[model samples]
Structures are given as structure tokens and as C-alpha cells.
Target chain A: MDFGAMVDYLPLFEQAMWLTLRIGWIGILGSLVIGLVVAMITHYKIPVLYQISLFYIELYRNTPLLIQLFFMYFALPRVLGVGIDAEACGMLGLALLGGAYMAESFRSGLEAVEPIQTESALSLGMTKAQVMRYVVLPQAVSLSVQSFVANIIFLLKETSVFSAISLMDLMFVAKDLIGLYYNTTECLVLLVIFYLIIILPVSILGTVVERKLRYGAFGS
Target chain B: MELLGLDVLFKGSNAMRLLQGLGVAVEISIISVVISLVLGMLFGIFMTWKNPVARVISRIYLEIVRIMPQLVLLFIVFFGATRALGLNVSAELSSIIVFSFWGVGEMGDLVRGSLESIPVHQYESAAALGMTKGQIYYHVVIPQAVRRLIPMSINLVTRMIKTTSLILMIGVVEVMKVGQQIIEANRMVSPNAVFGIYGTILLLYFLVCWPISMLARHLEKKWSN
Candidate 1:
């Protein structure tokens, strides 16, 4: 249990951390775009799609995310007649699952925007798209910051499950290293610290954004 | 093998798989929730103890639990802790330990909230009634607090069941993992079965979780009334 033993795996763990961040960035960005579109379409109260997306969100939100990851890895390729690599499967699974949650968060933010804001903007000679782009989204994004951040932390954690599918995510590296070395405790301890380093800054940023929203700087 | 349309739901084999998955998911949820509730109550009670030693330990425990992810905690227990301690832990046993320990922290926080949310006079009046401390807790504080606790605890149950899927990462044959194996086995001939099976798995989760969610809502309304 010497503390110095952890330092031996430092370079490999750093490479793993970089991979996790890369996956997180791609997954989070893709989901945000997809979620925002889905959320807005649902928010506008589209005829059939509104009900459909509602059902989708309900199904995704209630299930365990690890289940979703495995489902994607094993299922999607067969259905679509495509050969998806492990990374693609993992990322896509994460986005779909996380997108559903993000849609809910964005919708909460969208709902918080009073109808009056749009009405006033329309009265001020703004087009619907223009009003949404310039006025609604900025505020909604800011307002949803806390839920969004929490969901991201959640997404990061669930990424570990992608290891079950042989994705080269951070936890996979740790698990694989432990298998080779039989240093499960040390490897996992390093993994936890690596996550905390990434996560703590996000938490602090979320709090700051929340405070800004509460004051005059953010939401109206 | 990919199931398209609503016809797959009517298939006997598919339907049975759904039912089986639902059962395991529900069993895991119920066990973890009960374990956590008991542990959480104990931790909550520990929070109120006079000993600074107990209070500090509880505080440290809860903070660590809160900061740590459930998946990481699962890994720590199943992979790291058991190995380090030379313990041969079963997957289900490890899942229970990981979830319940996390639940204690969560439930403790909820308990603290319910306890603090009660007005001070309730406690003072109970004390003034010539009742003992145990009587005050059992008769006065707990019954009222139980109302608020029910809905919150129900939410925790939903979370626990959902989190239980992480057990599959350690090779426990849970619903999702079962679906994965089924899809993989069938993928060569039954191309469509992938989405079909996974979709069924998702719906099974929905069935298990939705009822509890409705119950939580029902409790909240009943208690508020």
C-alpha cells in the first residue's frame, strides 16, 4: 500500500484522462445540439412529434444508463446494417441517453421563459426564429446550466459503463491496467482522483453560473 | 432479428424476456431501497448524537459518498475494495453494499431535511408533555416526518433500481446485459432484432419505474392534502 506505487501508472492514466475528455467533449456537444433541436421541436407543440419525443424522453430517462450503453453496442449495428466501432457505439449511446435528459433540462429552462417575453419581442418587430435565437436560447441555456452540468457529470460517470463494450474510455483503461497488474485498488484510486479533478471544476462553474442567473447578469 | 413495429411485443419469447427483466429490476430496486432506508435512518440518527466524534465521522462519510459517483463506488467495492481486503464478494452482495452505503448518505440527508423542516415548537411541546425523548420521537416527530419522507424515499428507490444496472459492468447478468447477449448472439441472422430487443429492454424499464413514480406522486398529493 505504498503511495508511490500509483505514480508508476501516471502516464497511462494521463492518456486515459485525455481519451475521456475527448469522448466527453464530442458526446456532450453532439447531445446538446440534438437535445436542443428535439427539445425545441417538442416545445413548439408539434402535432405527432410532440407526443413521440415525450415518449422517447420518458423511456430513456427512467432506465439505467449502463443498460442503454450495452443496448447500443450490441443492438444498433444489427438494426441499421452498419458496422459501428466500439467508440462510435459508446458515443452514440451516450448521446441518445444524455440527449433525452438534456431535452428535459432545456424544456425546464424553456418553460421558465414566460410567454410574455416572446410576446414582447414579437411586438418589438422580431421574427419567431430571431426572437428564439437572440432572446430565448441565451436565457434558457443560462437557466438550465445547473441541470445541464449535473447531467454532464452523470454522462461522464455512465461513460465508464462503455468499458463493458470495450470502449477505450478512462475507466476501461483503469480496469484493463488492473487486470494486467492485479493492482485494482491503486488503479481505481487513481481513476477516482482523475474524475474528481475534472468534475470539481465543472461543479464550481455550475455554482458560479447559478449565482449569475440569480443576479441581474443572466436570466430576466 | 430486429423487431420493427408493434408486433414484437406480442411475441411470446420477447414478452417473457420483458417480464423476467422487469422482475430482476424490481427485485434489485426493492432490496436496495429497503437496505438504504434502514441504513439512512441510522446515519440520520447518528447525525443527531451528542458525540462530536460520531457527528464528524458521519459528516465525512456523507461528503465522500455525495462526491463519489455510484458507478465508481460500485467499481471500488466490487473490483478494488474486495480485492484489497482479500474478500470474495458476490456481485449481488457488492451491488447491495455499494448502493446501500450510498443510500445511507442520501437518506441521511433527506432525514435531516425532514427533521429540520419541522417547526421548533413541535419538539418543545413534546418535551413539555412530560414524555421521554423516545416517546417524543416515536409519537410526535416521526409520524409527521414520515409523510414527507415517503415521496422522497420513493424517488430514491427509482434511482437505486436505475443505478443497479451498473452491476452489469461487473458481469452480473442483469436485463440490459441479457439483452446485449441476446442481440449479439442473434445479430448474424436477425439483423433487426438488435433494436427490437434493446427497445423491449427500454420498455421493461419504463414499466417498472413508472408505477413507482405514480406512487410517489400519489403519496405527495395525499400527504399534502
Candidate 2:
């Protein structure tokens, strides 16, 4: 409601947005790496590691990201006797939680590649690794693109919880501004706009990519 | 070594407080889920209606819900509304309002999907059999949609329950909040209690959510057949 207050706090929100993007991007990248490894392990059904990956996936997926962050930020240091900063804890927690959901998305995508395609590739004298590299993964990646986008958006939104861990992400800035100025409407309106700015482009791009993928694959 | 820290849970009435916290979380989830189901059913039906305005409105609602984080929505409703709208909404009430708002979007989509999935021929056949529009929907469409709706809605329930953890941020004293309180109180008496207490809370969430997810999977598999 107060335009002047919102304008005055724009700089703070900008800084918070940058922090959010920095941590969210790094966290998403970490999750992508971890997810790929877990997906591969489960896809190949590797001994011992497969079970561990499955447990990791389920344990992370079934719990809230807030708890995971709290445990990592508040509890892990006490147990491990090492100090982890709030930002590191936020990034790590995001990765751990995002990894599980991404793994599920990737695994499903990998599974969606037809068995017949793999069989033919194998019979064509392609090694398993070559078949996976050339034939299966490309198709699987395309199939899972939508879910991957969804997971990315989900994880990014989850960065909101970093405020709870005392990280000055966008949400934290909004809450802090509100606490300081009592401009609840202004702070919250800015919060919503900032989030939309961050999320809308990804969401729009995701739709475009999905349409292209569908058309490219189906000739529709 | 870490097991000793769990002794804090057994000391005094700490465990009871936790169960109470869990109850609050569950209570919030149940209330919102019920509200969402009823409201979402209507929203879903409206979405599927042959009205461009309705479709556009629902689409915008869904997109807004999807784009904004639930935490932000909670803050807006809990903090912003009290100031802007001059409404004296309690934390729990605001939480329910936000959750139900979110659930309606989700559950409405589910309803729309299930309703759309009902074959066109079934509606035609019912019409041919001299059934009124209401009768067609009641006798033919809803029954089939409910079947598909059940498993997905159950999954939504689990999602809602997990998301209720966010309410603790706004000071709802849910399970996570209670766990934090217990850890803070026992920080000195049991420094290691941090790990045990949070780990226990993690386990408690797992216990509450895993079975529900499993059941959703079970129903999905069963109904798919």
C-alpha cells in the first residue's frame, strides 16, 4: 500500500534476491549432480549402492525441507563438532532435498526409454555404456524435461525457507523489512513481485521447452 | 553416544508436548484438506465447464498458486492481511486459509483431470438413456472420477501435512516448533540432544508421511489395474 516504503526497501530486496539466486542456482546444480548419480545407481540397480540411494531418496523425499535445513543447520554441527555457516547449510539442505525429487524424476525418465530400444542397441553390437550414452540417456532426458523443470521450480521456491535458518534470502528480507518498518503490505507485495520475477521466466521457458520437445518427438 | 541424548525426550513432559504439536499439525492438515476437497470440487467443475472466463480465471489462480511459494502465501495471509485488510486472523486460521487456498488449486486440478478422464461416450450413453445433465454427472461421471481422485487426493493430503511444517515459521507451534523448543530447553543439559531431538522429529515426520505415501502408491497401483 505504501509505495514509498517499498521503493526505499528495494535495495535490500535486490540484495536478497541475488543471494537467493546464487544459493538456489548452486543448490540446484548440486542436486542435479547428486540426482544424476543416484538415478544412475538405481537405474543400473548397482549392488549395495542402489539400496543406499533408494533409502536416501525416500528419506529425503518424505520429509519437509524445513526440517532437513534445521537438522543440518542446528543439529549437525553439535553432533559433528564443526561449525557450518547458514548459507552453506541452506545450500546443502536444498541439494539434499532437491536431489531426492530430481532422482525420482530422472529415474522415471530413464525407465521411460523403451526396453526394445536398448535391446536393439545392444544387438547392434553397442556396449551397454555406449547404448546408455547414445540411445537411452538422450531420450530419457527429453522425456523427463518437464518433471525436471517442475522440480527446479519447486526447489527454488523452497529457498524461501532459508529465512528460518537466518539466511537473508528474499523472504528474510521481506520479513525483516516488515519487522523494522511495520509496512506489512508493502513488504509482502514486494515479496510476491520479486518471487514472480524469479519464477515466471523459468515457468514460461519450461512451457516453451515442453512444447518444443513434444513437437520434436511426436511430429505433432 | 547419540542415543544418550534421546534421554531428554523421556525427561519431564517433553514427549507429551511433541505429541500435542504433532496433533496440531495433523489437525491443521485435516481441516484444510476437508475444506479443499469441498471447495476444490466446485472449482474443478467450474474449470471444466465450457466457459472461457472460468477457464482463464482458474488457470490464473493455479499459476499464481504454483508460482508463489506457500511460505510467502502464509506470510501474506498471516502478516499482511492483518494490516491491510484489518482482519484479526489467528495464526492457525491464517494457516488453514492459506493451505486451503493451495489445496483448492491442487485438488481442483485433480478433479478436473479425473473428470476429463471419464470417457465421453459414458456421458453420451447416459444422455441417450434420458438422464438429465445432473443425473448424468451424478450417476455416471462423479463415481468414476472419485475413483481416480482418491489416490491423488491422498497424495495431496500427505503433501499438505508435510507443508504444515512451514506454519511453525509463523509461530503455530507445530511438531517442528515443539522440537526446536525442546532442543533449546535441553541445549545445556544435553548438548548432543540437538541431533537426537531433530533426528527424532525427522523420524516422526517419516513415520507420519511414509505410510501415507505408501498407501497412495498402493491405491494408485490398485486403481490403475
Candidate 3:
């Protein structure tokens, strides 16, 4: 398994892991913003914007993330005449791709909130924005906690695709280390462990949140 | 002529190469889907079994698949496993193996969820009718589970097809890989080859996946009614 080779490569792996986490966090936060906005657009059923959001959701969701990354990394720069660094391009691709799925998840969550809740909030003299801000968004978040967490796990795993663009992420580092030492198995094990360290807690938290939302005192 | 840099998609051999790549994608997807479905069904049944060992094994399998990215899993098998095991597995074969194992986890969960969703009364009624366990599963449980399973399984098939794009990263000459090659080959002559080629691939994928999703939704509506 070339344990010594893996030990020597530990620092490199750590750096790459940090990069992966950075890209993942950036993508996660970006998607949350995009998902919330697009989901609300659909929820409000605004004429033109609703249609655009629907098309965006279907277009992104239907295609592969790799293709999306390729388009953004390769085509967008050519068309826009602007150079983008690998890190920025990778993060942008993940954000746009993850946003689509998040939009779907958020849309379902928003729909699960009852129309009556909004109506009562309105009748109580709250503006539409305030109603959505308070009554709908909080309950919707609680209701879709499971899907929200699932989307996070998905976003985390997807950061690996950034390696294709040479983003210096964990996967790219592992591949480079393997190329150097030919210790493919050891490097692979280390790769899995690095990801598991990150992913396991999130998944366990997902289950915990799901249970809490379902049976906890808040009482959905 | 260059309408948003999409005109190159219809130019010359680009279309043919992409079609060829699409064929490879479909071939890999079909092979993986068939293999995964068979194993996935068994895994699903095993997951729901009462035996402690069976349950633990299935749980571990499910968690590993859930936690790991598909691309990393591909790297592990193609690069890691082949070296460690001293075997010369082709990229296509490794993809099949990874996707099958992945399919087992996803499909098994779907099966488990659908099986659990069946009301307890169905089983009790079968028992009261003097049906043996095998008869109960064959006649009662399987039928009801199949109803709930078909739509989700179809969705899984579409997912497998879409995810097959990942195989390209491992050196498999699938649709996206072909598109890349075309873009590189035409980089000098056609400035918009990247847009044209990838846009076409995107449309091709949309064509394939959108219908399957629609079909799944249709079946869900039909069966629920």
C-alpha cells in the first residue's frame, strides 16, 4: 500500500483538502442564494421570471455537471473575452449546477408550506415580503430540512468534478501524488478517508435534523 | 451565421462524432443499468432482511456509496483497484463495476423504501389467507412494491444515464469526451466550437433525460390514480 509514500504526501493532501472545502463552501453558499431566489420566483408565479426560472432548473438539472463545467471553463471565456482562473471557474460551475437541484428542492419545500399561512399573515396586516420572510421561509426551511441537507451532501461530493479543471482540489492532489509515487491504492484510501471525515458528520447531522423536524418540539 | 456561437454544431463531421459518442454513452448506460438492476434488487431485499449481518453489510454499502463522490469512486477503481489487484481492467469495465455497486446502493434504498411503504395489513392479510411466506411475497408483497418501485426505478435509470458522463473523466470515450475532442480539433478553424459542440451535447442529454422524467411523472400519476 506504500504507506510511507502516503505519509510523505500528507501535507499536499491537506492543502488540497482545504481547497476542496473552500470551493465546496463557496458553491454551497452561492447555490443557496440562487436556489432561494429562483424558488421564490416560482413560488410567486411572476410571469416572465417564473418561466425563466423553470427553464433554468430543467436545463441545469437535465445535463451533466462535467458538460456544464466544460462550457463555463472553455466557452464562456471565449465568448466573454475575459480570462477566469481555474478556481473561479470551478466554483462558478459548481454554483450554477448545484443551484438547479437546490432550486427544485427549495421549490418543493416552499410548496409544502400551506397557502393559508401566507393568507393569515397577510390578513394580519403583514406585507407580502414580510409574510414570506417570516411565516413562509422559516416553516419552509424546517419542512425541507432533509432535502436541504441532502443537497449539501450532493454539493460536497460534486466538488470533485472541479479536479477536471485542475483546481488543486483533493482529487487533483491525489492524482498528482499517485503519478509521482505510483502508490495508487494508498493514495486512494487516503482520498476516501479525507472525504469521509468531511461527509460523515454532515450525513449524521442530516439524520439528526430529519428526526428533530419530524418529531421534535417544533412539531411540523 | 454564428447565432450565439451555436452554428458549428451542424457543421461537417462534428455531428457524426457526437452521435458516435452518444452511442457509447447509451451502450455503457444500458449495460450498467441491467447489471445494477439485478444486483440492486438483491441488495434491496437483503437490506430489508431481518438478519443482523445482512443488515450491517447493506448499511455499510449504502453509507460508502452515499458519502463518496462518483468521480472519486471511478478513480479508485480505475486507478487504485487495478494497480492494487494487478489486473488490467478496461475503463468501460471499471465504470460498469462502479455504477453497478452505486446502483445497488441507490436502487436497494428505493426498493427498501417502497417495501416499507407498503402497509402492514397487506402482509397480515396474506398470512391470514394461509399463504406461506414465499407465496405472500410472490403474490402480495412484490406486486404492491412493484407499483411503487417502477417510477423511482425509471428515475434511477435516467440518473444512471446522466451520470455516465462521469465515465469520460476516466478516459472512456463517451459523449462529453467526444465533444471535447471535437472542440480541440476545431479550435483553430471554428472559434465557437466549444459552444457549438457542448451545446449540442447538452441538447442531446436534455432530449434523453427530459422524456424519461416526464414518463416517470406520468407513471406516478397513473399508478397513484
Q: Top model by TM-score, which number?
A: 2
lDDT string, candidate 2, A1-220, tens digits? 7688788999999999999999998999999999999999999899999999989998998899998888888888876779998988888899989899999988988877778888999999999999999988888888889999999999988999998889989988888778888988888889999999899999999999997776225411
Q: What is the TM-score of chain A alone in each candidate?
A: 0.89, 0.96, 0.93
DockQ of each: 0.47, 0.75, 0.70
| Tens-digit lDDT track of model 1 for B1-225 | 325523454555756775676677567667878888998987887787879999889878875775677878878888876788888888878888888888889899888778877788998998998989999989999988889888988888888888877777777777766666665665565656667777777667777787887799799889974
lDDT-better candidate, 1 vs 2? 2
Model 3 lDDT per residue over B128-224, tens place:
9999999999999998899899999998898898889888878899888878787787677777777777777888998998989889979998897
Query: Against the native chain B, what TM-score does each candidate's chain B reach?
Result: 0.88, 0.94, 0.94
Clashing pairs in 2: none
Higher-lDDT candidate among 2 and 3?
Answer: 2
DockQ category of candidate 1: acceptable
Q: How well does candidate 1 score on lDDT at residue A151?
A: 85
What overall lDDT goes with each candidate model?
0.78, 0.90, 0.85
Interface RMSD of each: 2.1, 1.2, 1.4
Report model 1's chain A TM-score. 0.89
Worst 10 residues of 3 chain B by lDDT: B1-10
Ranking by lDDT: 2, 3, 1
Q: List candidate 2 stretches off by more than 4 Å.
A: A215-220, B1-4, B119-140
